[model samples]
Target: MNKLLKYLLATILAVSFINCTDNFEDINTDPNGISNQSLTQMNNHIGGSFTPMFLNVFNVTPAWNYQLQQGLLGDVYSGYMTPPTPFAGNVNNMTYALVDGWNGFPWSDAYGSVMPFVLDIKNAVELGNDPSGDKFVYLANIIKVSAMHRVSDIYGPIRYTKFDDFTTTGEYDSQETAYNAFFNDLGAAIDGLKSFESDSQFVPFDMSSLGGDIAMWRKYANSLRLRLAMRVVNVNPTLAKTQGEKSLSSDAGLLETQDMYINTGFAHPITVISGSWGDVRMGAEMESILEGFGDGREEKYFNPASDPALNGVFKGIRMGIEIEAKGQYGNHSSIGSVIDGETMQWMTAAEVHFLMAEAALRGWSGAGNVKAHYEAGIRTSFSQHSVSGVDAYLLDNTSTPKDFVDAINPINNIAYPSDVKIAYNNTGTNEEQLEQIITQKWIAMFPDGQEAWSEFRRTGYPRIYPVMINNSGGTIDTNIQIRRINFVSNEINTNSTNVNTAISYLNGPDNGGTRLWWDIPGSNF
Candidate 1:
């Protein structure tokens, strides 16, 4: 493990230096540093590159990296969890202060840890001229899309499509352009891997739950295509239908009974962040929705609050509230055993079902019976957590999200902003049915707050609580809420020209107030 870590760090440093220069070809071809020959023994040149990409997707080690990567942004914004510790004297991401120092993790982590490895894999495969190596490139592409899409969602424009081109390394692609490129790459990967479906070349290199199954990797790619397809349905329904239908009809199939998780070989970061550091706790919105619906997954997701005043109840802190100290909310419910394992979750079968349910709602082809898919989603999630009462839970119609009550601060209390229920509303309006599907999807995708937050911003379902504090200096609205994070300081400092060009692609300013391409503000219908 120590040897592998040293190698990964050395490779990353080499790649980082090559990537920083104006001419990648000049630096890469110079061959002064770790060369392909050095890594060729035992296929380490190609196989080893997969490790960093898998690890960085959720970043397992040094827990604080994971905290900055997603915990502070997606976890809180998605209403999944809130930090008890008030960093920067309470003026931070939670309050929409737009922390440049903190918000750069998602970008830096992706580019530094994930992207370079992907490029290396592609180069190694091409230079080797082995047809068998194409499978490695395909697998790397799948992982690249999975990791880079999250980065694109965070910041509206990202350095993708032309990342390997030295002349345009710093140029940014608009969110729309990036999504199109993602679809193209996923399509190529899905098609390219079909002939190699039975191949086991990936077994020794596989770190995911799929266990080196190429067919399963194809299924994951198809499912991810479906996910990205649905993300743009509102803005580009025709294109959405085309790609969504392709995913539905693909022989590669979608993730039905299986989930995609990367075995990071380390403790889940949330455990350390919530349990050891006492920095994170369940979000108030989570408490409102889960408790209001009488959700059986509550115990599976969070532990009872440690605060003696709460008396073992599942309590959560409201985000963006005035917190002078951590003790006020430090005893709030911490993450439970769900994330106690070593793997970092990527996608679930339950989430795939919900995506199909949404596809059905959109009247896309190959999406049979909306209610069936919706119910299947709920059942799959219940089974995943080993929770019971799924039958009665499916019949729930009277329950709605409960209003939140701040245990320590009454001023932080707020009403949950929805009346949506658990039962599949077959006869309800399109918008109402979407709310039901997205709300359930949001619940089932526990702890994967990046996707949850993106869906929340895209659909406006499962109405999350707005921040009580507004610290964006009026850049971000307290009501409409934050849309996307601003471009990182690293980019502005190093690639100011491209960063300015990227800002023009945004719907508004470059701050958190700006909406991305797919975040259309209107009814679901």
Candidate 2:
């Protein structure tokens, strides 16, 4: 009986040990840390994080963020759209008065919405030692370059390259250094993605119109590489040629037919322009250039002015106005429905073709010639807008940009700056040809005012209107106009030490008067 009692006790202890061993992992596991299973659920963490980054870059849902992110700044500065309402007692961005409160949106929105999500996937993929880690890391790198370039373009220097390290996280890279990093990042992405051409994991996670095809993304990246290469041609021609030729020579190809558009799952921000808000309207530049060319796309781009005094003509407001309320210029031509679609354009083939055209002019390899590339760009834009008679429009060498006529306030009207014709003139000087190319490119890139503003700063082609009132307090030159926005107050307040150090990177003051690294103040020729 003693032997039987010992055997029963041993059996009970063995059962108890088995139960503890079986439940150990479940009991010890923290619910907070993401499980490997959860990481693998959404195409290896790419879908969950990438979607928000892509969507919020444009900030489609909240109209006010878009207002500060673009409409009041780039749109106004680029000569694309101008707000009718004069907020802050009419002393605001439109009047060359930089609003610190409004100026912080682009930086805040980017760091808050876009970069965090990108960093998450980057960290996760690196830590997991996932077999597809290179593929995920490379793709995120492309998005990072694309998104951050805009930010750098906005404020000149930005928190890139060292953004991941908490110790040096707030350190800013000068625009030149940031651009070099961008090129390197893009190069890695192209090489890494080429190996994963058949990887179907990206398909479910894509928010772009390319349908998650790795090859398409590669092509888009190549096109983007060309765009960035062309951006630096004035400042760094050798680097520009090297990168441009690399993209031009790639079998992955450029954005030949399709424009890069992200479906934001929300309406385009232009709805705020044409809809009930009625805050924004066509710019004087748009009215003059479109009407001057007799371009058929004008009607598609804007409505006739509602001011009965103007007799239903397509009128536009000047950049700066001291209106008591929006009602003053609210009846001017609002933006058209073409920009009100679900997808937001990142880049277009028309703009790319013009880049190639400029490249050809610079004698870059693989860009056929100036004339062919120029005409192709115009034709592509015509087709994209569903406007016919491209042949006739291209033949019109007599039509120069018309002198702007402000029907409401004739004081704002100005004469055309250039006699540049529509036809591609091989006999013309290099400067003449460049102006023609950039002007058409500017028109093709309508409503994407941010890129247009950057191009305007770089090339100084397609002369934009000066602000009616110079409220910049002698900081911004009225003739030179606003070059780049001052680094936002958020950076000044939260990251004061780093922000102070960054001001040393600027060629001028840390104000709108300063030019960016790529925007060398001179003729491209």
Which candidate leads in lDDT? 1
TM-score of 2: 0.92
Give each model a TM-score.
0.94, 0.92
Q: Looking at candidate 1, what is the lDDT of residue 260? A: 93
Q: List the residue pairs that clash in candidate 1.
A: none
Residue 293 C-alpha lDDT in model 2:
90
Clashes of each: 0, 0
Question: For each candidate, what is the lDDT?
Answer: 0.90, 0.82
Candidate 2 — which residues are off by over 4 angstroms? 1-35, 38-41
Residue 209 displacement (Å), model 1: 0.4
